[model samples]
Target: STYRLLSLVLVEGARVQPHYIADTSRRSTLLELRTMHHIRQAVAALSPEGAARIAPTRIVSVHDIAPAPEITARRNRLTRRAYLGGQYDWLARFAAQFDIPALELCIHVDDKAHAFISEHVEQVEGEYWQLRKELVDTDLSLFRYFRFPVLHLTKLEMDRLARQHGFHEIMQKTWFCHSPWRGRPCGICNPCVYTAEEGMAHRLRPLARLSYTLLPVLSVVREARRFVRRVVKR
Candidate 1:
């Protein structure tokens, strides 16, 4: 979605970065690199006129582990809040060093951002959940150089935009798995679930699709567990 959004804009060149979780499988990372390589090759194969329309892009790696040790002090355990904070911190430094005017973040709009935060506040875990009791705000407006280009669009909306802009093929090359099994996406992961729920199951492998088929049953089991936990707490 972010890539598709960038394709519509006028930019000299693009530097793609992929963030990695220390403990999870590196399948997504590998896929990202491959996809970028494929894209560059496709661009190179294009006619000069066609290639000129697309921005030259390259992959750049940054220090992704423990960008915020205070919150992600536990080894291989980084919360979403801390992860994002770390990313913003790095972008701030990068922008200052290069004298860049502004930085655009391709984060899509989460309709349930507030709801998710509220629901997970009492829970022990969640990537996007707040680790501190006093901080309930989920807004990422503190970064002055950060601009959210797709802040108003949902994942489904982004899909529509991609199709409308003829970048759906490029978008299809994107990877979204956090925990992959044998180089394939684990369909039960948040990204897989969202992809299935957002009407993109055709992209998932057959086994992942099978797992997605059982998602309703799994959802029921989760709700039951949550209900029992709430009852026991009361």
Candidate 2:
């Protein structure tokens, strides 16, 4: 249902619509489509060829739901409440097009992410926490329209359950990319940076892993160089 966490906690026999918005990004590639393609392939391969357990991932067009592409996160960026609301509302309409009961959004909240959000509490003006919180609150309207509840599951818990089911390595097979080079992570983009910080090293390559692992040192060095320039100017 998302380009984020790979949902391995699929309910057996439940009609799950693993849908994605086939919206083109600034990078010129439909990264969601590519990622979901890999996910669908992995999901199908996991449970056996042509498994009836999980439904195929759906690719709903952005133009089909929203009036224009300007409302997307890529264009509008989730700064304003109205922009964020528009984004979620578009998704709600997309879901409403289907006769499904409700949408289940898989949210992966880790200690690192929680700490990051807490640290940025003072900078709530267009921060990820603020915008995400506002958009998440719209789940109520989504549920009311669909007449069902949207489930938010943690990645840690899902991993635990995956281990129980003997398929804890599905994430390694999943894909998350906004800007990819030769189908590999660019290792410097926002999604790649976050992917590194979130401790998915096993899924990423050496360069991507190093980009995140060395980010702190790089930041400090950059600041030190800037200070030296300032002193020289003085």
Task: Give the winner by lDDT.
Answer: 1
lDDT of 1 by residue, 42-71 (tens): 544533343455554423345433244322
Give the per-residue Cα lDDT of candidate 2 at 122.
24
lDDT for model 2? 0.50
lDDT of 2 by residue, 50-165 (tens): 34545666677677873424333332443342323234556656656664454543324542223222322222233112323343343233322322111223445555666675
Clashes of 2: 0
**Global CA lDDT of candidate 1, please?**
0.52
Question: Given candidate 2, what's the lDDT at residue 107?
Answer: 27
Alpha-carbon local distance difference test for all models: 0.52, 0.50
Shift of residue 69 alpha carbon in model 1, Å: 7.4
The deviation in Å at residue 97 for candidate 2 is 6.5
RMSD of 2: 8.6
Candidate 1: which stretches are off by over 4 Å? 9-25, 43-100, 111-143, 215-234
- The 10-residue segment with the lowest total lDDT in model 2: 143-152
